[model samples]
Target: MQLFAFGLNHQTAPLAVREQVAFNVDGIENALRDLVENGAAKEATILSTCNRMELYCNAAKPEHAIDWLAEYHKLPRQELEPYLYTLPRDLAVKHSFRVASGLDSMVLGEPQILGQMKQAVRQAEQAGTMGILLHKLFQNTFSVAKQVRTETEIGANLVSMAAAAVRLAERIFPSIEEQNVLFIGAGEMIELNAVYFAARNPKRITVANRTLERAQTLARQYNGHAITLSDLPEQLAQNDIIVTCTASQLPILGKGMVERALKARRHKPLFIVDLAVPRDVETEVSELNDVFLYTVDDIAEVVKDGLEARQGAVKEAEVIIESGVSDFLHWMESRDVVPTIRALRENAEHSRRQELEKAVRLLAKGESPEKVLEAMSRGLTNKFLHAPTHALNQAHGKDRDNFLDVARRLHHLHNDE
Candidate 1:
């Protein structure tokens, strides 16, 4: 089986297409198990984030794995095919290294994707879908990532997605200190945004999540209050800034909900940043007057503010990635010859055993020991040379020249010798 990677990311597909294929954190293990059990792959790991849904697999037929992705998500093959990228062997290795190093991220040099990839690998391991090939690939990938981060400034002056959300909010409001902030979700992204926004010292911070306990835990960090998602309708109108990132498959805040909230607040302006893949907020809510809504994609431009400063580091990172890819491919090539190397050793041992047995029989028959030793040495020599000598005698045209060259090289024979 060959190493293969196929996926659609923020660069290849818009949020609408991405969300359709995005796997939630809870479903990753099952999805990985199904991919392997269904004969699509021998090994598999999935990296599903707000910006990308990637499957890394060791499979004989990569097309089968591609088809499996569409089938698993209930999307037509034709529909998903346009946005998908299929990388095989060396390309797969290079892609994995680049992704782990943050070279392939939508936000150049963002560090979060490395953690996300590690989480994906952990999930694959838990599901028993991580085979030797994938495990080695990720191990090398993480090593390369560490090398890049250490040797270059790719991660310096980073404007993360959370920071970008705050920047966008600053553009809408005169001052963050004057506005009340509502964070919807207790996930990492929401926590990040809350941290950034909290530093600006919003008037009041409230965390709303499906579970009150999780919300309460996050809210306590900011000296704020917590509420369940069910309290959103009643409490929504009180907040001017809403930041949401959740794992729910459906939109948590629909257009009707936002419209009512706006009405209750007497048409006060509301700024929302949704970092969720399937979207915690409805798309139509962007159309409402006095409402500014931003999805994960919308944060891309804002996050590019410091990209030019990191272009030099990108070159350094690419140099590191290319070296990594070359090393990994060489290792893979060496593995491909293992069986042949083993067979050659086994064949030589068999011939030696046969010759030794004959030598023992000759000694038992009272033949001279010295003569029997010479005979055994000669037998072993002939057995070792038999295959190459026979092949040389039978070969014709270019095959004869090729065999001669291989024989010369194998025995270290010079032309003069």
Candidate 2:
């Protein structure tokens, strides 16, 4: 199987296209199964995040996988093809290593992509589409990611999405330490945002989720409060800052909800960061006079800092990634030889057994031991040389030249004996 990774990311596609093709947590399993079922991929793992929607696959043909992604998403292949980048063999391996290392992220050197990749692998495994190639790719990806993180200062000064949300809130409140911060959902992104905001020792931290029990569990870690989604309308007006990231297919906060909150607060500025891919906050909420809204894409400019300083580290990362890619491709190449190698060994063994039997019969029929041994050696040698010698004699034209050269090289090498 050939290794490949193809898709669009923050650098290649705008938020509109990215969101259109983005898969939520619920969609990953089906997408992976569909990829294999449709003959697009022999094995597949799709990584869908706020900034990227990539497919890492092992397949007989890369074209089939690319067409599958576009068709499966109902996107025009021509339109998506411009943004899509198909990396084959070594390049694909390098991309996987770099992506896992966070060198490919919009905000370079962010650790979250590693976790996102792990989640993708888990989903692929659950879907029963993760075969040896993908399994090894993911395993090597994790090792490379850990090496990059530990060996380089790539992750230093991490002004990630969670951190950027906190920065935007601090801009609104002057000091986040005095304001109440609310985090919606108990998912990984929300938990990360909660950790960042809670670091400021906010007046109070509240986690609101569809499940009150889940919210309470996450909230208790920060000495905070919890509430169900139903409590938002009653409790919304109380918070000064809100950060939300959920996998919901629909908007969690619409114009009606925020407008009501604004009136309840009598025009107090509310800082809201919607980190979800499809977006938890309604688009109209951005138009509100008192609401400050940002998204995963909006914070892209903020978290993208120290490009020049990190350039040195990025270059270092590229070198490591190249080494890793070459190694992985070498391993894949070796795997390709296994069946042929096994076949050749079996053929040799069959010839040896046939010759051995002939030698035993000659000895049993009262042939001299010395004569039997000599005959046995000659028989095995003749058997080994027979097929290739015959093929070389029969070969003609292009096959003649090639087999003649091959036979000459083999004879010369063993003729030394």
Candidate 3:
């Protein structure tokens, strides 16, 4: 099967396009089943993050998969063509290796993409869309990622999104120690941001999640209290800084809600960072007076602050990925020849069985043992050589010479004759 990886990312597509195509974690299983059920691919796995939405699949035609992506997102093919990138065979293998290695991230050498990829694999498995091809691809992907991380200095001085969020908060407020920090959602991003902000020993930390138990679990780690999404209205105006990232399909913090918060605080400047894909805070929230709002796309610029030091690591990382790609492609090539190998073995077995049966009948008829064994050996030899001899006789000029060379190599013949 032809392996392909196709989609758009932070490099090929802008945040506007990325968000439009981003898959909700809750809906990925159905999307994967749609891909296989619709004949778009034989095997598929989707990697959707705040920065990228890539679909890797085993298919005969990569174009079919690309069309599936456009149709699934309800976008015209022409609109997505400009931002889409399709990598076939070896290129797809290399791209998968690079992505899992963090060489393709908006934040250089970030570790979060690897976890996101693992989640994608799990979702595909649950959907029953992950076949042997994808299973082997991901297994190699995780191995290569581990090698890249362990063998190189790629992750050194990494500027993670969490760290960037804290840096942005620092810019707005003189001292994190003096500001009250409110974090929305208890997911990985929120947990990470909580860790960074907690380091500064903020005045108070509050985690608001869809489930209070999850929020409470994360809150207990930092000696903070937990609240549900419903508490936002009464508690919103009390915090000086808010960093929100949740899986909610709709915006959790609306313009009117924040406007009331601003009025309650008497127009004190409020810093807000919305790291969710659909965005927990409304876009209109940015238009409010005395409010500084940053989304995942907005933080891309901030994350680039220390990227120069990591450039050297990127070259090293690419070399590791190249080695990985070569190994994986070799494995795929071996798999491709499986049918040929099985057919060859089956043909040989049939010839041997036919010759043995004749020899057994001759021995049962009381023929000389030596004579029967000699005849069977001759029959087996003739059967093995017949096909090659016939082909050689039929060949002309270059074809004849090429067949002769292959026959010689197959039989381990010397050129002395």
- RMSD, each candidate, Å? 1.9, 2.6, 1.5
Off by over 4 Å in 1: 356-375
Candidate 3 lDDT over 215-308, as tens digits, reads 9999999999999999999999999999998878789999999999999999999999888887788889999999999988888888887788
Segments of candidate 2 deviating more than 4 angstroms: 357-373, 391-417
Q: Write down the worst ten-residue block by lDDT for model 3.
A: 10-19
What is the number of residue pairs that collide in model 1? Answer: 0
Q: Compared with the true structure, what per-residue lDDT tens digits does model 1 show for residues 339-399?
A: 9999999999999999999999999999999999999999999999889899999999999
Q: What is the alpha-carbon lDDT of model 2 when measured against the actual structure?
A: 0.87
| TM-score of every candidate relative to the true structure | 0.95, 0.91, 0.96
**Candidate 2, run of 10 with poorest lDDT:** 408-417
For TM-score, candidate 2 versus 3, the one ahead is 3
Instruction: Please report the candidate that would top lDDT against the real structure.
Output: 1
- Tell me which residue pairs clash in candidate 3: none
Global CA lDDT computed for model 3 = 0.91
